[model samples]
Target chain A: MTHNPTIVVGIKQVPDDDEVRIDPDTGRLDRSSAPAVLNSPDRNALEAALGVRDDVGGQVIAMTMGPPPAADVLKEAVAMGCDDGVLISDIAFGGSDTWPTSLTLARTAEYLDADIVVCGEETTDSSTGQVPPGIAAHRGWAQLTYVEELEPLPEANQLAARRDVEGGYERVVADLPVVVAVAFGENEPRPAGLHRKIYAENEFEPVTVDANDLDIDEETVGLEASPTNVGGMETIEGVDRERTVVDDVDELAEAIRSTEVFA
Target chain B: MTDIDPSEYSDVWVFVEDHDGDVMSVSWELLNEAKTLVEETGEELVALVIGEDVDGVVEEAIARGADRVLVADDGVFEPYRADPYGEQFRAMVEERKPSIVLIGGTHTGRDFAGRVAVPTHAGLTADCTEIDVAEDGVLQARRPAFGGNVLATIICEEHRPQMATIRPGVFEAAPPENDRDGEIERVDVVVEEADTLTEVLERSTGETADVTEADRIVAAGGGIDGDLEPIRRLADALGAEIAASRHAVDEGWVDGSRQIGQTGKTVRPELYVAVGISGAVQHLEGMNDSEVVVAINNDPNAPIFDHADYGIVGDLFEVCPELADALEGAEQPEVTL
Candidate 1:
């Protein structure tokens, strides 16, 4: 039997869309006001990993990093068929950008000895596609970004993953001990099994780790060490819409035809 | 006004992106831009070419805009691999003490810029849309952030050499300054074969779309649903290339390479026609610099109209075909690539 490589997926709990509110004063996303939920793309990533687990018969683990409230995303990941879940939650992790976040995750991933590490291309709130690349940098691991599909290559201890390129997909055969930044549509995230959901909800009591646990220098993982910093933010005011209602498709067609914009 | 002393830094360097014998277009673009900056500041525009046949590449750099091209050619530098490239770049910067290092925001550029910036302890602004010297003589690099909704100007005050990745197509290529003369200085690129960490062994370049050379673009957004045959038809009608937002590509209605946004290509077509796109900040950042923008979406409140020269709020399926038909009669414009 082929060796079933261990897989690990990282998830983030974000504010559900309904609860996502803009801070009128700052125009930044109001994380405090929004109710936290599992990151949707991360769920898709978990599904991709689980699909690999099912096909190849391997162990799948999920990990998360956030404040105390981030444990909820771990439970949700476990409920989605992951055999185990780990949460790295601490106050020190607050205000961390992609660099430190990836550093912490790299430490956790190294601890897990995972052959494959999967994560969403970006977080719902930050939305900067930096974590996967940064993690690869921290661990010196090969990164297969914008992964749309994955096929197992057991013989080479590698997987053939397709990354979305400018005009076509770049099929890369990445050796194991790799990090993948998965985008949506690679697979439709499977619904959490009833028994797994029940088990995850009741049995999950998340384990947290602090700065002391990981052997890392503090300057590299926080706002101070971040390469990019948010200068400031302003709320986007809703545009004043001048509605030109067309009663029929002809009027719309005529308007589009007459427009000299593209001309 | 805190004026940066020119004497503080010694040289002006352009990061040359070349593989095998062919130099990337962005390298020439950066040299052209860097030449302008150096000329304006009365500094020498130097090229740091690291690869095989360094002399020929350096001559090419001087032909484009470099005042002096530094050549560090060897077998290890044959391909623009990340580790050696970063090490070489950082070493040159430390040795020569360049005021600013400009890199093209290509795949290899990003890889080298990310690693070199960290080790060199220099500030790096990625995918910068604009680069300028402030009145104080500080290098000001402007880039879109928060999904291109807002533009931020970054500066490196503490660091010696200011670094930035200039996005392709952001600047136009100017003719070479033939009157100016430059020199090529070859250096030792002495890394043993055993020291090489990663081998290119083989590389398969993706089929070229040449979307950047397209005069016109038909970009689809979240508004378009179902089959994309209609969009393709419109693209065919205008001889325009097809592009998409992240949403459309994520839907699997289109390939990822056609994606235009933060994580995708930055296009500056002569005419950009957006179909069913809501004009998200991410999408807008990629195409806002287009010469002309026409938006077609059913939602009147779509954000795309803010930068659009003309907007038609309606079903794209209905309006797209009509637009295609209308363009058939209208004289097609020429795009200077």
Candidate 2:
């Protein structure tokens, strides 16, 4: 029998990008202004993990690290066909930057005995694309980032992925226990089934782990442990355009030509 | 690891990314920017080049204003497997202890820097659009966050080697100084094949050009209705690159690399022409920096018109072909006295 790799896919609840706004006075993101939803790419990551599980017989677990409200994403993951969900949440994990956040997730993955960890290419809110590789680095595991496709070589105990590069794509094969960062929009996430949605909404409760549960040093898992600090923030001022209304395509083309763009 | 004294670190190091034996322009751009930081900090400007047979890259780094160049020329780093490259970089950080490390925010650089920063406990800022040195020799990395709505300046106050990944094309590359001299040192490659868990099996180049580097871009949106021929013709007439909004990319009308938005690549082209795009806030966030924007949409109420310098209300199918013809006619030789 082929080895069933235990896969843990990381998901996050992020503010809807279209609605996200920054407070002009404080230069800080106004989280309350936007409604929270499952990050789009994380949905793809979960879909990727589910696809892997369906191909080979294995358990697909959804994992997330955020505040209490982050559990919604986990329940949503369960509704989408994950076997179980794990939420690493605590007040201490709040204000944690990518470094500590990644460390905590790495420890949680270890605790879960995950053979594969999948993450979105980046969270829409931060768009850092740091956590996936950071998790791998913390645990000394291989990573395949910006992956668009994945094939499980169950017999070889490895996963092969097609990942995006600057101007092209490359195919890579990694040993088990690798972190895969799924590219955004690469796959169509399946809709929640009626039965699964009903069960998830009423009966599903994700396993919650805190800093203490993961044995993470308190000093290394919060804002105090984060190395990068926001020195300041400023809103980008929108430029006032000429807003010249042109009559026809010829006039528009003439206006474009008048600009020094081609020069 | 965080206990290291900040005073112990010295010099500004820029990682020179090598792509298929050629050094990426972003590397030299970083070296140029690092020159100013080194002058303020009273430290040397160093370039870190890691790849197979990187002698040519080393020479370019020195010519581009590197006071010293560190090389890890080995086959193990040929295709940039994260494990070996990260290990080698982490080992160097522990030994040499540079004050600041700047890497190009490319796919390879982002992957390598994120992995190395965790083990080294370095503070890494991503996709920095601007970088400067403070009076105390601290590196101030400023980057856009919250979908380019706000720019955040980040700093590593206590960290020894402050690190940042700079977006390409944000800075200019300095002119080469052929007579410039610099010291070259070899980095000890401690990573072996056994240490690498990932192996690159194959690579295939795509046809789409990098829109981020283009001076002029004609981008289509969902209103194009899955047809790119009109967009391509307009781009060809204008001598511009073809790009698309996230909507068009999701519809499979264009390659993902050609996408521009909050989730896609941020671009600051000289001239941006939006065709049939409604200009969602996310899409505008990516191209708002363009010097001039021209929007063509059937709806005058399209939000894209708010950000555009010029707006034309029409069907893209009609406007595109006409505009292409008009631009082509305008390209004819002018009568001169």
lDDT value, residue B117 of candidate 2 = 91
TM-score of the A chain in candidate 2: the value is: 0.94
Give Cα-based local distance difference scores for all models. Answer: 0.71, 0.88
- The digit string of per-residue lDDT tens for model 2 on B160-240 reads 689999876667788899889999999788889877898999987656466777888899999999889999898888778
- Recovery fraction of native interface contacts for candidate 1: 0.09
How large a fraction of the reference contact set does each model reproduce? 0.09, 0.80
**Which digits, one per residue and each the tens of the lDDT, describe model 2 over residues A1-263?**
14788899999999988777767797666878899999998988998999998899789999998887889998899999999999998888878889999999999999999999999989988888999999999999999998989999988989999998866889999987999999888899999999999989999999999989999888888898898899998877777898988998778877988887755
Tens-digit lDDT track for model 1 on B149-265? 456776666455777788776676556655667887876664565643344433445544545557789988877885687688778777789989988978878766567776566
How good is the docking of model 2, by CAPRI class? medium
Sliding window of 10 residues with minimal summed lDDT for model 2 chain B:
B328-337
Candidates in order: C-alpha RMSD to true structure:
4.9, 2.8
**TM-score leader:** 2
lDDT of 1 at B226: 57
